[model samples]
Target: TMDIRKNKIREAVQTFENLEHRMEPVATVRGVDFVNDSKATNVNSTWYALESMTKPTILVLGGVDKGNDYSLIKDLVEEKVKAIVCMGTDNSKIHEAFDGVVKLVDTANAQDAVQASFSLASPGDVVLLSPACASFDLFKNYEDRGKQFKDAVKSL
Candidate 1:
């Protein structure tokens, strides 16, 4: 009985998918991968997402600012991100943080953000939605934000 249970546990672990809104892969459209990490509503979470990136990234960032300090991810953004699509009500802070470091575009919604990020991407590049701020400003929640991102990617 113990052996059977252990094997089942191992199988479950092997088959387990990442949680929704947390490093979820939405789709790959025209060779560009789209990832939804909308659960990353803090600098540290976004940092981990950026740290794991292996390809050039067009990052979709922003939402409801919770007094987030962009400096924490500045170096990582400079290193891994090729462009930034700001999705939020107020994006002046995002622009201020990433303007000279990378190309920045402002967007007010998920579809626009995804489209802008896609436009900035090339083959083998990734469009990552790892907003380091709360989603209340534009979305009901992180899951809602992630769902919108997925839907937009599917539409492409």
Candidate 2:
């Protein structure tokens, strides 16, 4: 009985799917993958998302700054990111942090961010929405942000 239970647990773990707002693959439109990682509301979480990328990435970053230290993910961004789309009202800090590191585009909403990211991406690239700050600036919460990102991807 114990052996059977252990095997069942292992099977469940093996079959587990990614959480909704954490590295969730929203869609693959025109060979460009759109990923929503809105639960990543801090620099460290965003770093993990970037570290897992195997393809060139257009990262959608920004939100209500939570005293985030962009330096924590600077090296990973330099290595993995081809461009950054800032989806927030004020993106001066994001631009300052990534100055000369990569191309940066500022957007005010989810749809614009997705469009900008898609335009910047080529086939086989990824557009990752892993905002490294809180969502209160433009969204009610992280879940709302993730949903908006998914909706934007569906429109593409």
> Model 1: per-residue lDDT, tens digit, 1-156?
999999999887756546788888889999999999999999899999999999999999999989988999999998999999999999888888887899999998999999889888999999999999999999899989999999999998
The 10-residue segment of model 1 with minimum total lDDT is 12-21
CA deviation > 4 Å runs, candidate 2? 1-16
Q: Write the per-residue lDDT of candidate 2 for residues 28-139, one digit (tens) a residue.
A: 9999999999999999999999999999999999999988899999999999999999999888889889999999999999999999999999999999999999999999
Query: Top model by TM-score, which number?
Result: 2
Question: What is the model-wide C-alpha lDDT for candidate 2?
Answer: 0.93
Location of the lowest summed lDDT over 10 successive residues in candidate 2: 11-20
**How many clashes show up per model?**
0, 0
